[model samples]
Target chain A: MTRLEDMVGAAVRDLADSAPNAHDLASVARVRGRRIRRRRQALLGAAAVVLAGAVITPYAVLDGWNGGPRPQPVASVPPSTAPVVPVPSTVATAPAIRKDWWAAPVRLPGDLVVTSVGRREVNGPNGVTAVAPKTVQEGNVALDRSTGRYRAFSGGYQGFDGAPAGRYVMTDDGITAQIGILDSVTGQTRQLGHGSGRGVEWSADGKTLLLSLLRGGVRLIDAKTGAAVDREMPDAIALCPSYCNFTWLPGGEEIAIAQRDPRVERSEALPDTVRDIRVFSVATGKPLRTLPVPGVPAGSAAWSPDGRYVALLPDAAEEDGIRIAEVATGRIVATLPLVEQVRFIADDQILTVRGLDVGVYDLTGKLRQSSRLPQDFLGRGISLGRA
Target chain B: MKQSLEDEFTAFVADRGQSLLRIAHALTGDRESAQDLVQGALAKAYARWPRIHGDAEAYVRKIIYNDRASAWRRPGRRNEVTVAEVPDRAAAGRHDQDVTDRIAVREALLSLPERQRAVLVMRYLEDRSVEETAEVLGCRPGTVASQASRALNKLRLLVGDRPVSMGGAR
Candidate 1:
């Protein structure tokens, strides 16, 4: 035998000798056995129940009757007297139902068009707020597809529901002006800050707030004092004359913004073609670097942990795939093939909603599992948590 | 209904689970993942017990092979390769000769493609006939022969020129 063969044989033998505890194996077997037993029992019980129902139903029906003799049936009307109305196949056709109807009832509060919705749980002395019902909204704004319109509807009330108590920030009219802190016990909301912006992100420690100004640069605000920090992004970075979106990393030290560059591109209307992802130091507002996403026409960008990768998805009409760019090298690492829309579950896993099935796949292209959603929940967004 | 079948299953797992795990470990190259793969295969067999019990071992083996194959075809799914740590030569001195040999074989196995590796394990390690391996893999016997031939040739190159004696063989 060669050295490699000898070595492999040795490892296999060693693994067998020091095999892990049988507990896991036994547990798996036991679970399988239980499932088999339950299914068998259910089948047998169902068969017996059907048999019993068949035997007893006729007797019960006979016992309920007082009179045994029955009369013959009588004819009601002749065919000639009925109206001779012609039926048009075209007129009988049902109106085309809008595909967005099922998703219509979920409305966002008025005065606040929902920019995004994230599911979170808050924990407190109230013994874990009942995992809010499936339909409960987490963020403000209801985006309706019915009339292809965005309307603000009420009903999204933020509260502590088994999540760690913290002050949650909200943005108004693209400004970070209003902040609400939920009371851990009473589940009451208290206002904190006054700022306006399209986007707001809380720091990792929940001590600092980051907001993007609609006309220009980003602003860092003290979460407690509601005061703007002296640090403002440089004019070069702040040159976005129209729309800007900000995404924060977990560490809170950095934020990435997707904005149009006014200097490089100019148009009478907002230049739809101009888009870029720029990293900035949250404390200094100094631009760190601008990374261009390949294959992505650039509309929205989100950062992965360590800011090593950014996920870019174009507008709704564009084909879907996520581009991963290495921050240091700015080279494309991988372009994840996905359906029209996908939600990142973690750094490694993505939950993709395709048709009626929700597929879970790891970063490396392995499909872990898939589950079908109910018809009503088909068009609605899905949120996942450890059960 | 039969105590004997249950006992047989327990003994089968005790006797053959390691061998199955070795093949799975070779394919995934991770102990935890191999265990999951084995359990998943066994679960699938259990679900079809009435039909599978007659050939339970073969049924489970087929499931493991198919699952691993299907996983490789998914688009944009990347496989995370986790290599087992190589113990220091001095520390490994106390291990049995056979144990060390098995480890070397597993590492070499990991270098092969999913199909080639499965063919090798089923034919050489499990001592299955070419027809039997082909049946398990759902391929023609001729294809199995060709795959096994290619896999063995690759293994010869991977195992290198060092000579060692098989503990129980001539």
Candidate 2:
């Protein structure tokens, strides 16, 4: 036995010796097993009835029909109708690098999600109010860089995703978790659904919000009206009963979700050892295509402004880096070692943060410019975008 | 769910329930969740007991590991939590140092990613061989080695420069 092993063993020694409870676990397990068996039997019976109906209905309709010729069978729809425009792996497609990108003011398509390291004052709702530092730790405000105005959110919002002005998808840290959209302008939050709010993202156009529920599955709702979008999409119960992370594709009409292989679930392999990113249409909740790219968490995925490429912090970065992949082909275009946060500032320029330093990189994975953040605003912060 | 099968399951649970609960406690770091995990695994085993009664413990253990692995990914769980650092202090006695070290290791273990933590538990606490752990996890032996190494490095970071002693690296 090694010293390290001894320490770990000793740590749980008392726990190992604890006595079993007085409850009859065997009886409880039997009851649960009975429920499982009953459910399976019911499902089997339903399946048999469906099979019978399928066979009988086809024969009944064909026997009564007397058409000149049987209508030709409709062709099966292809998995994807999107164009496959593959770029040569050797060529760099990004625009000319701007060496002085960091010198000028940092402009972004969305608000900057920041966690204040110290007390600071900025333009607030009423007037300039002293905002406390580290109020919500993981970030609580959406700072509009142009006007220097900030909208602070309550409910322990992690500030992972936000819209242009001050709207954000946040989950309340209460007994009954309420996933909603918080409009800083009106200081009101309209509940959209119930979830952990940890896996929420806005669509590329910022009109819809995708919320991953704790019970299982994702929900799409209109950002403005708080009304449910994709009314025909599969509900949480029928979609996924296990953990799932979802993000809207370039267009709000579709979404990408992480799904593990069935073999992993059956214990033939390690749990969640392999996962594929599956794309589905938001309207009909039908699978469209499967991206060979590994899946990532919701907020970690960003679609380029042109909607041609997506930058993701994959489950396992090859060299502790982020990957930029062509959306249509799912081919990795570039890999950059930008550890913390990544977002596209323009169609070609990518903004990244590694620790407190920010770097601008092109599509070819070359660092064009780099600069350190201001002393006061420096801390672990996530750079959020409108998408 | 025959009476004979039921009797066999009852006897098995009575014999090994506490041990299973101990493993669950190590995996989840809480007694309530440990009980829930053990009960859930046992119930799953019961659902297929007639076919798996010969190797019931192995089947139940696999369920326990896989269920706990996926449970940690729940958004309501600890996935989004950021722990404040624990300040280190000079120890007054050997007993105090031992207790502090144990607590620190426990915290560090809980903070690891689900797979990495499972690797550590299987390797150190259960004293399982590398190949055995790999088979149970359904991964290549190389992956088990890498995960264990990464997990230990993270533990060292969290526990602050304590000697990890890689003399037992299998």
* Highest-DockQ candidate: 2
Give the TM-score of each candidate. Answer: 0.34, 0.53
For residues B52-134, could you state the per-residue lDDT of candidate 2 as single tens digits? 89999998887776663223222212221123334463467978877777667666676666677677778877888889888
Q: Candidate 1: lDDT over CA atoms?
A: 0.40
Candidate 1 CAPRI category: incorrect
Total clashes, candidate 2? 3
How accurate locally is residue B153 in candidate 1, as Cα lDDT from 0 to 100? 58
Report the first chain's TM-score for all candidates: 0.44, 0.56
Candidate 2 lDDT, A11-85, residue by residue in tens: 545444442352566876776565445434433342111111000000000000012232111112123344333
DockQ of 2: 0.22
Global local distance difference test of model 2: 0.51
lDDT of candidate 1 over A122-177, digit per residue (tens): 22332222232333333222233334332332223331111101333232221122
Candidate 2 regions off by >4 Å? Answer: A11-111, A114-165, A168-200, A204-206, A211-220, A231-246, A251-253, A257-300, A304-387, B1-60, B63-116, B129-132, B139-166
Candidate 2: deviation at residue A156, Å? 11
